[model samples]
Target: MKRLIARALRRLGWLRYDLLISPVAQHPGKNAVPPGELWLVIDTGVKKWACMSCPGGCGVQIALSLNPDRRPRWSVETDFWGRPTVSPSIHQHRACSCHFWVKKGVIEWCR
Candidate 1:
């Protein structure tokens, strides 16, 4: 289900793969985070990577793309801010960002 939603984000123009990076080299200040693709995802950078931003440690999230191993990972930044974090909760069910773009329009999940 997660992978499906993630893919749908790509289908629309909302979400995009923005970078080819290694945290080790890209962010050498912190722990020697094992080499992996580091994305400069728009709000994702602040929302999920607040630890990487200021010393605030505000927005933080786990990478939805891990294999349940020691290998750290990047975050999944689906554009769903300012508008609707998700569609109006309906009949107890929830509509995620995927559904939003699928219904409304692209949020330009930038980098």
Candidate 2:
């Protein structure tokens, strides 16, 4: 059911993933982030970090820092409909090595 909806959204030029914002200091728990979704944990009322599963089907969770004081951090922008666009690009340096861009709910893969 969820997978079908995600695929339909992707086919419609929307992102297969959605953003789930949580105003908490710690990750809610395991399974808090669904597949094809990004969880933004806002700490101190500021965007502190973002987490999402590897889109490459590796089943690994990627954590990106949103803190401006940190180097190599990324920022997220939300559209009027609440879709998220992550600036620059995300490149995993570890296993999978998946690199891609999340723009307006679509994942554009890189070579």
Highest-lDDT candidate: 2
Model 2 segments more than 4 A misplaced: 1-25, 28-32
- The lDDT for every candidate, in the order shown, is 0.27, 0.72
Tens digits of per-residue lDDT for model 2, 1-95: 55466557767976545443333466535554566567777777788777788788777788888888989899988664445688879998777
The top-ranked prediction according to TM-score is 2
lDDT of 1 by residue, 1-111 (tens): 544564566679655532222222122344322221232223323322311111112222212222224334333333432111212211111222221111122222312
Q: Which sections of candidate 1 miss by over 4 Å? A: 18-111
Question: What's the alpha carbon RMSD for model 1?
Answer: 14.3
Q: Please give each candidate's TM-score.
A: 0.18, 0.73
Which 10 successive residues of model 2 have the least lDDT summed?
15-24
Worst 10 residues of 1 by lDDT: 50-59
Error of 1 at 91 (Å): 50
